[model samples]
Every structure is written in C-alpha cells, then in structure tokens.
Target: MEQSLYLKTAISAVRAAEKIIRRYWDDGFDVRLKADESPVTEADIEAERAIRQVIQEQFPSHGFYGEEMGSIRRDAEYSWLIDPIDGTKSFIRRTPFFSTQVALMKGNQIILGVSNAPLYGEMAWAEKGHGAFMNGHPVRVGKVTTLNNAALSLGNIKTLAQGTGWQGLGKIVSGVNRTRGYGDFCHYHMLAAGQVDLVIESDLNILDVAALSVIVEEAGGVITSLDGRQLGLEAKNVLAAATPELHELAREYLRVN
Candidate 1:
C-alpha cells in the first residue's frame, strides 16, 4: 500500500474526530475516571468511535489501538494508533491545547501521522520519506546546533524529577537559551514547525507521542526515548531535538544513573 493512501486515511480519521470533539466542546459533557484516575469524557469516546469508523471504512482489515477503546487485532501487519484527544485534561478545562492524534504503524514502524487541533485551527501531518506539513504548508525544524542557542520545551517532568536524570534535566534547564513547559501536543507542533529547538517529556504513553515522532522526524528533527532508544510501543519518555548534534549532547547530560 502507498504511504499517501495511509496519510489520507489518517487525516480523514482526524477530521471525523474533530467534529465530535467540537460538538461536545460547545455543549457540556460529563467526565469520569478510568483505572489510572485520569479523566475520560463523552467526547473522547465518541471521537474515537468516529475516527475508528472512518479508518475502518478505508481499511477494514487494519488493526486499531485506541486510548478510549482497547486494542483490536493489534498483531495485524498494519495498525492504527488513535488518541481521540491527546490532552483530555485540557479539553475538560475548556483549553484549546487538546488535539486529535492519528498514526498508522506498519509492524513496529510508524509510516504516517496526522494531528488536528480543532479549536486552534492547526493541523500537521507527515509520512516516512516525505516532508512534514502544517496547515497545508511545508514545515521544518530550526537549525540551532548548540544548547546555549536552543529553545527547549518540557512536558510532564514529574517522573524525571524523581529519577537519576533530574540533575541532567536541571543542567539542560540552566544551559538552554529559553525554556517553556508547553506540555502535550502543543510543544511538539511548535518543534516540528521550527518554533522550538528541543522538547523533553519524562512521562508519556506511546499513544501520546507516536504521531508526534513521525512529524518531528519528518521535519528534520530527532526523537527518541530519554534513554536514547528508538521510539517504539515501549517508549515512556521523550527527548526530541532539532538536530542530531544537539540530541547527542543532551543525551550525555540525560544519561540515567
């Protein structure tokens, strides 16, 4: 199958999810807690349902691993990873930072991704070997090579603070030109569009960062776990940089004890 077809399907799925999310956003919805105590809402469920329907129509045989819904046929050669709302807490708080995330994974590799922030009116997508784009325009990461010249974004650093990498993170914070905690999809979007030079998150799920990994890499950036491993289902942290040199330098300070 061509990657363009996969990209089209992912975008269509994201659009379907956006409609459901907007409807609930305008009205009101009830929130509930899941096993992990994280919030879930009607919008999340309905959006995932809508996204899954769109993708299934395009490729019924493909598997699905969704945040709202559990995995189905997860071992299939091709699978879709869906996060109907990447920032559910933000959504519930009436913030526009939330987004619909969709990515197609062939075996262990992500082949394409689409991220849509409905209220923000921004969308980004990318495919392997093809360039990344935002709002229909091509995008790329910044060219900052040194930490002193780089702008860094941090997300979900609670776990990092409790680990051996805490000091390393402090060093990064002190050395960077500027830092912002633009947690969730917002920072990744900015990084891919060259608005930020690096992004770090010590806690996240694969569903939260899979689509983002594809976008950042396609935009001429490097993304991996804090441990310097390639992103896969098992990834728990993120250390994405605009250049390989910056990434390697950050990795040195971030090495786990």
Candidate 2:
C-alpha cells in the first residue's frame, strides 16, 4: 500500500504542533511533574492536542501512541508515535532544547518521521527507501568510523547510573569520544543529521523513540535498544549510532555491564 499520504499528514501534524509550541514558548505556564517525575506543562498538552487533532481529522483510522493522552487504536499495524513536546523541562525553563516529534510505524518498522524543534529552528525528516533530510536538504551521517573519534549524545546520566549501576554506565561512557546532552528525541535526529554520532538513553516512552528512529535510519544509522534488540513499542532504553559497528560496541557493554 502507498503511504505517501501519511507522510503529508505526518508533516502537517508536526507543523501544527510546532505552532502550538511556539505560542507557549516564552510565555509562563504552570509547570508540574508527572507521576514518573517527568516535567509536563501546558505547552505539552496544547501541542499534543494540536497534533492529535490533525491526525484524527486526516487519518481517523490510524493509531496513536502519545505521551500525554496514552494509546488509541493501538492494534493497527500502521500507527503514529508522538511526543508533542519532547523537552518539557527545557520548555518550562524557556530554554532552547524542546522539540516536537512525529513518527509513522508499520508493524515493527518505522517508515517515516519528522522532528521539529522550534527553539533551534530545525526540522529533520525521512521516509523509508528515501534519504533523510534536514530543512529540505539531504543530510547524511558523519564518517566517524571509530568510537574513540565519535561524538555522543546522552540524557540524564543519573538515570542510567541508578537503573544500571555505574559499572554499566561507565563502560558505555568510556567507549566514546565526547558526550553532549541534547533534547529528548532530538538527539536521534542529530545522529541522522550528522550533528552527533551516538546517543544512548534510558526510560523513554514509545512516543519519544518511534518517530526519531526513521530519521536516524534514513540518515544511515541504526536505532536499537541498548542491548542491540530491535525497536519495540514498549521499549524504554535506547542507544542509536551512525554505524552498526559502533552500535554493537556500545550495546555489548550495556548488555554485559
């Protein structure tokens, strides 16, 4: 079945969500924490609502796994993975790290994705069988062959350490060149866009990793769990890289640590 139509809908959802986020961008919103201790604000709710509205209007039969609203039509093979506002804490602080992520998944595979970070004025998108692009220009992963020369992106070392212990986190950290923190799902886009070489994070919702997976893979990278497993709807940990060799090197450590 042709899915180009879904691409248009995915793009629209991201753009609509971007506008919603931009409105709340420096305006003060009541900030609070979710049950999982993650930040949530009005921007997140409005962005998700805007994106969901478009998705429902355009593809009512499609499924959605969203951060704020939970799951709907989830049994469908083709579904959307959405994180309306990825960096809620950053958005709350009026920092420039938050972004909106939308991904289309067919069964276990991600076919297309778009991530818009209004604060950074960037958009990364890709469709399966076609190359990835950034702001309409084709983007490719870097030539960082060796882990020692590769740059890395990570979120919350504290979580990694607490969940897997320092031995696990240390093995993975020491194997890379340098690690920089990026927004929730933006790190994967950076990998696909060649802005970063590697990213590993723990405790992510499906809405956080799904759409970003296609962006990375289309940019010539691999997106998998830290243990080298295939991406899953219920997955919570991820480590993506520009090359499979680097991915395995990191995955090995995380697995046995």
Candidate 3:
C-alpha cells in the first residue's frame, strides 16, 4: 500500500479509538492492573480493539502492536503501534492530559504517527518528511538552544529517583532553567507544538512512544533513547529536545557514568 493510504488508515483508526475513549471518559469506569501494576480501563481495551479492527479490516497484511493486545505478525514489513490511552493513569484520575496514540512503522522506520488528545481538542499527526501538524497547522519545536535556558519536562519523579536513571535525572534538573512534570505522551505533543524544550521519561514501551518519536522529529526536534542513540521499540527511557544542541546537552546529563 502507498504511504498515504496507510497514513489515512492510521488517522481513521485513532479517531475511532478516540470516540470509544471519550464515551467513557468522565462517567466512571472499571480499572484493572496489568502485570506491571499500571492501570488499565475498559476504555483502553475497547479503544485498542476498535483501532485494531479498523486497521485489520483494511490492511490485513500489515502487523499490529498495541498496549492492550500484544503483537500480531510483528515481524511484517509494515506494522501499526497503538497506545489506546497513552496516559491511563491520568484518564482514571479524570485528568484531561491523557491521549490516544497511533503510529505506522514501515520496516524499521515510522512512516506516520498521530496523537489524538480527546479532551484537549488537539490532534497532532506526522508523515515521514512531511513535517508535523497540530489541528491541521504546522508546528515546530521551541528555539531554546541551551540547557541553562531550557524548560525540562519529566514524568514520575519518584520513579526516576528509584531507577537507574536517578543520577541522570539529577543532572538534568540541576542544569535546566525550569522543570515541570507534564508527564506522558502529552509532553511530546507539547514539544511538537513548540511549547516545551525538553522531555525525559523512564520506563515506557513502544506503544507508549512510537507515535511521539515521529511527531517530535517531524516537528523539528530530536527524539531518541537517553543514551543519544536512534530510538527503537525496545527503548525504555527517552530524551526529546528542541534541537540537536539541546539534545546533546541533555544526552550528556542523562548519560550513565
């Protein structure tokens, strides 16, 4: 299939998922804990199911990797990655920052990505080499070139403090001009919108960040593992920044010594 065909399919899939998610957003829903103790809701499962069904119906040959459902034909040349609700914790807490994320990977490259923010009324999507867009307007990363002037964003501080990334976290916090906890996929969307300069997070799967990586990069920012390497599905930590200069500085701070 052509890239455009896949991109349109992904957009339709996430939008379908978003409808399912919004229907259950504020009415109180049951939550369960996965093996990692992360919160999962009916919205998450149903949203993913709807997305998978939509994608599969149109492109049966393509693969799928989603948070709610595991891999299917994962080694195929083309695959879709879905995080039905990227911040289910926030969703359960009635916070509006949660979003539905989707990405299409053509071989090793992410060809298209979308982050649909149901409550925020923002939809960020990107096609490889075509740039990123928010609500149909092109967006770019901020112009903060130096860490001393950069606003650093983070996920759960406690999780950072207890993990192997604690030292790097300390380095980053000490170097940045300001720090905020905008946690989850929204921070990357914010980065793509040019509202944020840097975002660091520990412990995430491919479904949590594959779409974000493409969106951020197409928005003229850098997205990679904490070690400053190319991002991949296996990456657990992330460092996304507005520029290569800032990304390098962040990489230095996040480096394990």
Candidate 4:
C-alpha cells in the first residue's frame, strides 16, 4: 500500500475510536486496573475495538498491537499500534487533554501517526515523508535553539524519577526557561505544533510514543530517548526537542551517555 494509504487508514481508525470515546465522555464509565496497575476503561477497550474493526476490515492481513486487546497477527509485515486513550487518568477525570493515538509501523519503523484530541476538537497527523499538520494546518517545531529560551514540559515526577531520577530532572528543569507538567500526549502535540520547545518523559510503551514519534519528527523536531539514541518501540525514556543542539544540551543534564 502507498504511504498516503497508511496515513489515511490511521486517521480513519482513530476517528472511529474518537466516536466511541466521545460517546462515553462525562457519561460515567467503569475503570479497571490492568496487571501493571494502569487504569483501563470501557471507553479504552471499546475505542480500541472500534479502531481494530476499521483497520482490520481494510487491511485484514496486517498485525495489531493495542493496549487493551494485545496483539493479533503479530508476525505480519505491517502493524498497527493503538493507544485508545493516551491519558486515561485525565479522561476519567473528564479532562479534555486526553487523546486517541494510532500509528502504522512497517518492519519496526513508524510510517504514519494520528493523534486525535476529540473533546478538544483537534487532530494531528503525519506520514513518514509528509509534514505534520494540526486540523489540516501545517505545523512545525519551535525554533528555540537554546535551553535558556526554551519551555520544557516534563512527565509525572514519579515516572521521571524511575528513569532519570530527581536530580537529573532538576538539572533539566533548571536549565530551561520554563517548565510545566503537561503530562501524556499533550506535550508531544505541543512540541509538534511549535507551542513547546521540549518534552521529556519516561516509562513509555510503543503504543504511548509511536504516533507522536512520527508527528514530532515530521514537524522538524527530533524524538528519542534521553541517551540520544534513535527511538524504537522499546524506548522508554523519551526526550523530544526542537533542535539537535537543544537535544544534546538536554541529554547532558539527563546524564545519559
């Protein structure tokens, strides 16, 4: 299939998920804990199921790896990654920052990504070579070249401490002009839209970071782990920045070698 086909399919799949999410929004849904202690909701399961139904219909032979449903046809050359609700905590709290995330990976490399903030009425997407866009308008990472002028967004302190530790996070915070805990997929969208200059987080799975990886990269930013390594599904500690120079500077504070 063509690259555009991948992107279109991703968008359609997420929008299908968006419908289910919006239907359950503020209507009261049950939350259950996964084996890892992460929260899961009816919306998460149904939305992922909704996405799978759409994608599988079009590409029956493709693989699927979803947060709720796990994997199907895992050995297929083409795969779909789904995080039905990127911020389920926020979703359960009725916050509009939560999003639906979907991505297409061909042989381990993400080729398309779609992130839909349905409640906020915003959608961001990108293909491998195509540029990133928000609600059909092109977006790019900010031009902040120095940490002194950059606005940094960090993930939850507990998760950050798990990887880089408090001292390392302190070094990163002190070096930046501003810092905010815009946790989850919100900060990644902000980075892609040039609203924020950097974002660092830890303990991410492929479903958490895959879509944002392509979106941020296509927006002319770099997305990777704190160690400055290229991102793959296995990357846990993520560091996304507007420029290579800023990324290296942030890595220095992160103390990742």
lDDT digits (tens) for residues 1-257 of candidate 1: 23477888888888888888988999899999999999999999999999999889989999999998999999999999999999999999999998999988999999888889999889999999998999999899999999999999999989999999999989999999999989889999999999999999977899998998999999999999998888898888999999999999899999963
Residue 164 CA displacement from its true place in model 3, Å? 5.8
Task: Per model, state how many residue pairs clash.
Answer: 0, 0, 0, 0
Best lDDT goes to which candidate?
1
lDDT of 3: 0.86
User: Which of 1 and 3 is ahead in lDDT?
Assistant: 1
TM accuracy, model 3:
0.93
lDDT of each: 0.92, 0.79, 0.86, 0.87
Q: Write the per-residue lDDT of candidate 2 for residues 8-60, one digit (tens) a residue.
A: 88888889987777777646678878998888988888888888899889888
Candidate 4 deviant stretches above 4 angstroms: 1-3, 162-165
When summed lDDT is taken over every stretch of 10 residues in candidate 3, the lowest stretch is: 156-165
* Residue 180 in model 4: lDDT: 92
Q: What is the C-alpha lDDT profile of model 4 across 1-257, one tens digit per residue?
A: 23476777788888888878988885778988989999999999999999999998889999998889999887899999899999898998888888899988899788889999988788999898889999989999999989889999988546667554567778778878999978788899999999999998876777888898999999999998878887876777788999988887887777865
Cα RMSD, model 4: 1.9
TM-scores, each model vs. reference? 0.98, 0.90, 0.93, 0.95
Local accuracy of candidate 3 as per-residue lDDT tens digits, 1-257: 23477778888888999888878975669998999888899999999999999899999999988898989998999999989998898898888888889999989888789889989788888998999988888999999999889988997556557766688778778988999988887789899988889998877777788888999999999988777777778877788999999988877765642
